[model samples]
Target: MLEAIRERYIFNKCQVIILDDDGIITLSDDHLFEVPNAQPIENVHPFFETIRHLFDDKNEEHVFHCIHLEIGDVIGNYNVIFNSGNKEQNPFLVLYDFTENCNYIQTIVQRRNESVIALEFEQIQAQRLQAEQVFKNKLIATISHDLRTPLTSIAGFAELLQKQQGTPQGANYVQLISQSATVIKDILDNLLGLAKLEAGVAETQLKKLHLPELTDYLEAIYAPKMQQKGLQFSLKKSAPKNAFIADTTRILQVIINLVDNAVKFTEKGSIQVFLSVLAEAATEPILQITVIDTGIGFPQEATEKIGSFQRFHSTDVEGSGLGLSIVQGVVKHLQGKLDIQSAPDKGTTVWVEIPIQYAAETATAVQTNSDASITLAPLKIIVADDNDVNILLFQQMLAEQENVQVIAVNDGNTVLDELQKQPVDAVFLDVHMDGLDGITTAKLIKSNKLTKHIPLVAFTATNSAEELDMLQKAGMSLTLGKPFTQQQLLQVLQQISATK
Candidate 1:
């Protein structure tokens, strides 16, 4: 039965190789890892240089899972298994292709994700039943677990590759891979954000926001894309003398989505973003963000359906229109207003207005003597994460900083033991772990006299208000969400150092 299945399903999708005790490939089937045609296959290709290290141990069998191998024009996703049982027997390597299986699984997941999103939209429009809410929560959890974790590994490796010295073509390939991973990460974030919004579990974190700095950051991000497309992009700021208190993350999302939409649709013309404060309103001052784009516009009839998971020109555009929906949701939650105007072949203009109050206290500048430089004290940080990939990513991100050392531990208990031995500046704990979860560990650390002074930062993917409250109550000084960038980590560290 097994033989029949193999012949039917895996006929030409398998590759084989036989190696001597010294890990030299003597025989090859020329499917996945191909042997040279004219050469004796001893070590002809540069690709084999790194791969030969896998067989250095001639006594033990090795298994590598889901390796995407490219040789010449042939590319295959394979699971490689090497058997080097006894010294007397030659080692055999088997490569099994699983590309079709992966595609099938991806198709199924895509269909399921679409269905769940549709159901979530319906729930948001109607009364949100408890069962449906629970189902949505489970979907969110599954997405975070199944997608974001693996994406982190991919992104981490891509970042590492970017730091390595390689040929121009190799560097370009790594850059492309990094960009693709970022796009995937953005899609996942949007899906997760939409799900959380529909479930009414999204948390709003309001803080002081510097408008000028925000616009500068957004322009830096989209300017290159605009240049690449041969489109003119300009950012205009009106007189807003003071910073305002707002949900920084949501506001960033709103503007980014609007600008991203403008960039995506406009091909030959210009896109402009304006930030100004309108004080003539009846109630209070309002912050207005307007985006103007010269692109294909929609009909007046479709204006009302813009925020209901609606898409215009579905065939011409590749988008789910979730960005606009997210923007609308955030505005409504903030008790703000959204206005959109467009005409076919003319242009599109979107205005987002949110009520605001100028900050009570303005930031004061500090002057330091340039000739007398300040020196930072030596610091040690303990990072506790159950996932090895996360720990490695953290270490790599912090590796270049001077006067700082990072010690990695897999669990909370190990963290406590490490703290007992040496003093550290800060401890970053992953909220979920195999044993002694972050909250409990944090409480224990805070309650102890010796370690209570050390700052404890929580790294979590859960953005619910309840989770944030729990972390705060458990004595967490701060919480950073998952899929965070190196700059964010550095900023957190800087803040901790300043506080200390």
Candidate 2:
């Protein structure tokens, strides 16, 4: 019977031992207990003595229950059940290993604790990020609003100075002031654009663009600067004249940024811009643009720094170090590639390739009567703006026009009252104003039968798509961004007048 019990327990990895009535161990499965050679249970295991005492009172059944034992560094959880049948046979002890179950439960608890901690950490980081984004957006809004009014005045007055007759030196000084103001405005615009792009609010609006007209505009704008710097500038176009379907504004921005960099670095060398169609396939037309400048070239190491807000030139040159970054972002948004090649003394060449989408029907350019050719009719216009500087700037710009009366209002309520009192041809509404906002005033004007036909043009510092859409829905006929040039203002006036 003892041999049978020992063999059965040994096969199942359970420790079994038989002890006589005198508390002496008679038999033990040392292998099951992890003992080296065959030894008695009382000699190897420390808990043997304590377990033997439980069978002293053999009158009833004795069960020692669960016991925890440590052998060297290993821990075990064991259950001891004693069998003393009728006092005729020696008592037997059975130890069932519960170590694996205990370890498994412990591992599950540890993993759960780690998961809970990680979840809490992620929640904290999310809340912190949201707060930071809110703060950044507010700062951008405040800066844009505060800087636009002064910038408008500076550029507006400088333009007026350019039109007047003066000495060559005086005219040159005026031109410099105007160019400097424009550069500042461009920097601010780029910063705002970057912010919008980061916030996922800006998008590309593609339209049909005439390449010839674009080249002409660039030549007209930059040729004078090149001449002033004693440098030659040229724009070349290849065959297979094509019109590109693209975001005209962003494309223009990219080209302008590249040209500006070239002009700033070049003193005596020439700058050449080439625009052409690389492949003439109807389905996938590719446009290649290259701007090559023989200027102060940068080291090869600088090529790696062609990303966000990085500059590779001296601090003496005035710039925000954001032009190339903005260009790269715009190119990526348009699904294009940009390549730069240069050496220390040699010039730099920037090549850009973009896919061209051709419209199904070739677009015809809009033809408007020249400003000098258009006969003016006596008209009354309202210029509603809260800022005194903006109002003065608008009045000065309009003073040169013939047979047009401009009335200024500081608030939205006055705008409504002025229209009701007098006959108005058009309303130039500023979107940000006290008492009532521009959108609300426009809605009111459109609702009234008397003034419903009058055209409403929104003047705002922000040209965001959402803002423009809102203005359009509120019955605005046109939208103009702030710090606009004199030519832009005149063009808008002419368009509205022709429609009227």
Candidate 3:
């Protein structure tokens, strides 16, 4: 039984020491000497120092529990109990070492604390980046509007001058003015697009697009220019259907940049655009668009740097190379694929494949028409814009219509007052106006029973996605950007008329 008790005592890692007038009168075992980190009883240095105060008051009994001390050179965690009696009686101390266990627990707590700090830091960084992106998007929108407003007046008057001028020299000057405005607009678009993409805020907004109409629009834009350069341009579609769901703006941007590049490089050869559907079933279809041009082709090395802003044949070509870079970024964001095939002196072919869903209702083919041949029904329109030039441009664009009447206002308050005075067929509003903004005016118009039936159009210079969404929510059914031509305005009028 005694041997069993001794074995259990050592296993429990317990030790006891008795102290008298001479100190260390007796020890239960040699466990303290056996412990590697503990001081020998003969030294009585740290251990005795740790409990000496308890015995100072000899007349009163004292007990110390769970006391930790430096045993030798190593600081260790320990639970110690001490009892002191009168001076003539003995004092006893009990020790239970827990240094290893406490160290392991301390390490775990330190790691957990570090992990919490790291997570908090990451959250803060993410929030900061998100805030910065919002500010950047707003700034881009403002800058675009400010720059494009004057450009719109410049281009609009240039078009008017080109029509009024009879001499070939005067027409040539007007054409240069118009072309310069267009080039400036293109540069602005490329810079804004690149900025958005680099900031990772180039969002995708999906909508049903009529493929045939899109192609027709592109042809109308580039055909005349290509003809002036003595180059052939044609757009073809071999799709099973005419409608697909995608980001309409992004799709237009991609195709426009590709065709523009083709037109810029191709000195004499033809530029052809093809749109086709690639799929095994109608439920999940992939739209493939290919742009082939017999242009001054680039080297194979240039093909490898599609997403980068690396200019090709820079010695002869005049471009920042941001066009193709914007195209690549938009394609990637849409989870599509882009391929370029080219060789020196050989024409280049660029193709993009995007997964899409066919619209629920397929649209019929749109018959293309010249702007001069189109006309609108007799209608009274209210136009609101802060800029007098924009208002004047609108009046001139509508002057050709036989019975169309345009009532112009410089602010949204006047627009509202006009609506209150008379019934109009449509309301055209610039998004930013003095006194009352266009968005609030739109909401008021939409909410009122008297004016809610009229078609609302946002003809503004700001075209940011966030602002567009705001305009839509405020009940604008259609949005046309500034620097628009007579044809575009007529198209918007027709659509509004048709909807009504």
Candidate 4:
């Protein structure tokens, strides 16, 4: 019956062996054992020792799980089944191949592990982005606070110098000082503006603008600078004087930045600015402005370096390398395009095209009265700040005005003590103090009805709008950004007095 069963089921490739009680292969269907003749399984493969127990106690039907086997170059998985109907019947061993099933299972396991690793990598990337954003915010705040304080002092002292009747040379020196401070302030503003735009916090204030008036203003501002450098400056306006809807401040800043670059680089040749409408539609019209300068131009290789903190010009030129970057950002924000054309020793021309909408209302010009004088009533005010220079600046700025009693304190606690001694009309509280922060102090003062009526103005070097909003929510009546002009300071006081 065993021989009949082997003949009926086993094929020519089947590895079947009939073993005797001594575990010797009495007969075999194949020579996979690499034996010169039929031999025992123990001498064939290393995995035989692990399955040797099955041959020892084969009293009844015995079956073993799949085992890996490698014979020379051929690899496979096999299940061993032994049949022992009686001692008289030689126990026959049958090895079944399951290599394909094992390979399929291994592939599934490998794919599953890859999926898990991919998920873990995504989580790590998310965490890294969050950390990066937090670091960026902290860096911006620290830089804004540290840099604005000194700039404020320099500008304040320069303004004080202007108020005095000094010699012509001294007046020139004061003008230089003021101009230097303004340049530094512009650089800082550009850096902060880029940060805000990158963080998606910048918002545009759009208004109706007249192109001819804007070009005229630019000519007025840059002509003097060009004359100082012995360069001819001209503004050509080919665009219509139609009113257009745009961000007045941003557009003006972009123009100023472009003109400033042209004036800075040009030595003797003329700098021409041309404004024209490149394309006109009912809703969206394209406006093009060109700033062409004959100066030490850059090579063709440096053309790609025209954007974002890039200095392709000579190192002798003084700039923060942030002008073009800020310009690019503003153009992108306005849905515009920027192009630069230049060559070595030749001139450079920058073209900016922006899409603008037509506004129905006529654009109004901004009016400024340089000769106007401001008068203030006699009132008591408390100033709390940690910086001594800022305190002195406040005193100097208020010295010209009559009967303005200014009491200066160093910390928030001193501010409270001063308030206790006498009720002041307003309190200038620095947001970041050593002992008590301005927000906590304001909260405490507002909680008490006796001191709540007094206006609390936050004096901070931080340019973050979010920080100002937080201070306002904490009961601060108003906020004064650092490096403030004397006019801005007086304007806040005037508003507070008017409210009273």
Best by the TM-score measure: 4
Return the number of clashes found in candidate 1: 0
Clashing pairs in 1: none
Give the per-residue lDDT of model 1 (tens digit) for 152-216.
Answer: 75676676676675877557757666666776677678767876876777777666766777888
Every model: Cα RMSD to truth: 29.8, 13.0, 13.7, 13.4
Ranking by TM-score: 4, 2, 1, 3
Candidate 1 regions exceeding 4 Å error are 1-218, 234-237, 240-249, 281-283, 299-301, 307-318, 342-347, 358-376, 416-426, 444-454, 478-480, 485-500
Candidate 3 residue-wise lDDT, 58-84, digit = tens: 655444444455645545566666667
Worst 10 residues of 1 by lDDT: 311-320
Clashes of each: 0, 0, 0, 0
Give, for candidate 4, the lowest lDDT window spanning 10 residues: 311-320
Error of 3 at 93 (Å): 29
**Candidate 4 global TM-score:** 0.67
Residues 1-500 of candidate 2 have per-residue lDDT tens digits of 98888667654557777766665567767434654333444565678765555666774455554467776565677766776534577766777777677678779989999999999999999987986676456555544654665677667657666676586756775766776677677778887876775576778776666688889999999999999999999999773655557777788888898888888777778999998766556467766789999988776656555532242222112332455666777776677888888675688898887776775564434444465744446668999999999999888987878777999999889999998799888999999888799999999999999999999999998867888889999999797789887677777777777876
lDDT for residue 125 in candidate 3, whole number 0-100 = 100
Best by lDDT: 1
Model 3 weakest 10-residue run by lDDT:
311-320
Provide the lDDT at 191 for model 3.
68
TM-scores, in order shown? 0.56, 0.62, 0.53, 0.67
